[model samples]
Target: MKYSKATDYALHTMLFLVAATPNKPIGVQQLADRQNVSPTYLSKILTKLVKAGMVESASGANGGYRLKRNWENISFLDIIHAVEGTASLFDCSFDHGSECPIQQVVLSAEAKMEEHLRNQTMFDLAKKNKNKIVW
Candidate 1:
């Protein structure tokens, strides 16, 4: 299943922030530039994360975005749900409330995916990718 571009940006933003110095906020422009995304678009994504309680923002000269929780506590699933909601690959609902035959199968797959994502966290990923990625 494919997620929206917003979701991709949100994940990237989270990963970037996970690497930042604690209590030190990163400016939107700086983050946008580093991520190679539009500042306006990134700001909207950051707002969504902030509202989801995954990230926090500050105001004034030192104003910027930071994670609300530690990277170890922030699961990849959390970021996905924060940006995309609990959207399934296939909609199980039908008109008149009719039960779809494939609903169970789809739901099972979704559950598996959720379980896998929930088991993984930003800190875990950072450790795994530390040597491979630049940051």
Candidate 2:
């Protein structure tokens, strides 16, 4: 399933935060500039993350945002859930309240997707990317 732009930004924001010094808050403007994203849009995404308890925010000149949990403790699914509700591949709606014949197959795929997401974490992503890129 395709995620909204907000979810996309939130994922990047999380990755960027994890790459920074742990427990150190990074300003929105600084982060936006580094990621080449609009500070205003990034701020909205950060607010949602803070609300999800995935991020913490501080106000003032030296204030900014930081990850509330370690990268290893945070998963890609967590970021998606924080921004978008569920990561279901597809939502099947049947006519007249009748269940679809292939409901079980759809549900199975959704479960597998969730399991995959749960198995991966931000730290895993960072390490995997740092390893190499094969053409």
lDDT of each: 0.82, 0.78
Candidate 2 lDDT over 73-119, as tens digits, reads 89888888888876456656766232665776778777888788878
- Evaluated at residue 119, the lDDT of candidate 1 is 92
Error of 1 at 54 (Å): 1.3
Q: Candidate 1, residues 18-122: lDDT per residue as tens digits?
A: 766645789999989987889999999999899888878998899998777565688889999988988577875565233565887777788999999999888
Residue 100 alpha-carbon offset, candidate 2, angstroms: 2.7
Candidate 2 collision pairs: none
- TM-scores of the candidates are 0.88, 0.84
Candidate 2 Cα deviation (angstroms), residue 36: 1.9
What TM-score does candidate 1 get on C-alpha atoms?
0.88
Cα lDDT over the full model 1: 0.82
Model 2 misplaced stretches (Cα beyond 4 Å): 87-89, 95-99, 130-135
